[model samples]
Target: MASISFWTTGNSGGSLTVRSTAGLRGLVEAAGFTEVEDAESPAEGRQVSDFAESGPRSMVDLVRGTGAPAVLVSFLDSDVGFVEAVTPGGGTWEALLNRAVADDYGIPLDRFPVEPAVKEALAWAAAAGLTPDEDLLLQALTGSAAFAEELSSLLLVALGLPDPS
Candidate 1:
């Protein structure tokens, strides 16, 4: 429950591996986010007033810019959530907490992963060269109709993203 939307890059002992803030800015801007600003608390992280206009592309560019796995998680009132990730080798994955809620918001369900892709989590871990909790990762990928905050937290841990808090 950090924020409605946020980007997190892979970290080594809490240190980010993103090449530089400028590179990150370029990626974010390319993804259709304008006026990107660095988050004061999280080093090498950025926050937007709302979710990115091009979420999946933004995530892909994040991995490309950081040269490591990257994650983007967004929630609405902690009731519905969406999470997307991309590995360094171009592997991409995502999941949605509540497809119905997303559709209600006029957000296209097809744009997000509505079905289960638990195996992709393992693939992401392997590509990232890290061992994550299998059970937690699977559950995160499975997603639930409620408790979007929990889903977001699970994704953060499953992908080995640092906890800004």
Candidate 2:
């Protein structure tokens, strides 16, 4: 069994405790989703901290070092499972991030990073696989015509898909 915990970051507001894998699965179960992973041999060293850094290997290093099977379930871009899971058959990262920002912060994408908002949103969304490409930060700040396209493209390229099949 692999355990996980989620931490949320906010602009000025700081961090919030989200949930642990045990808690998440319990929620999922409560919501009618079955727990699929065996809890007997859970992944070790579960640290539900603030989120990973902004690079490819750094992300892998952080996740792998956590000893989480969710890491294996979360690999993106270079990982074939992520590609195949998210490519044509899955949800969109942009949609998830937009929803998160709108639903959680009451802020639109254009209004993000209103002063350290980037640190919170980027790190938060990126960690959640809701916004993957670090490259999005540049175009988003510019509000360029390419912003939408680049964001979408980055969302497509960088998201980590959940492949249960």
Per TM-score, the best of the predicted structures is 1
Point out where model 1 deviates above 4 Å.
Answer: 1-27, 34-37, 40-52, 98-116, 143-147
Against the reference, the lDDT scores of all candidates come to: 0.53, 0.27
- Expressed as tens digits, the lDDT of each residue in 79-125 for candidate 1 is 56666667777777666655565667675655555344467766776
Please give the clash total of every predicted structure, in order: 0, 3
Q: Which candidate tops lDDT?
A: 1
| Residue pairs with backbone atoms closer than 3 Å in model 2 (clashes) | 1-41, 1-42, 4-21
TM-score of 1: 0.59
* CA lDDT, candidate 2, residue 35: 26
TM-score of 2: 0.23
**Model 2 superposed RMSD (Cα):** 15.0
What TM-score goes with each of the models? Answer: 0.59, 0.23
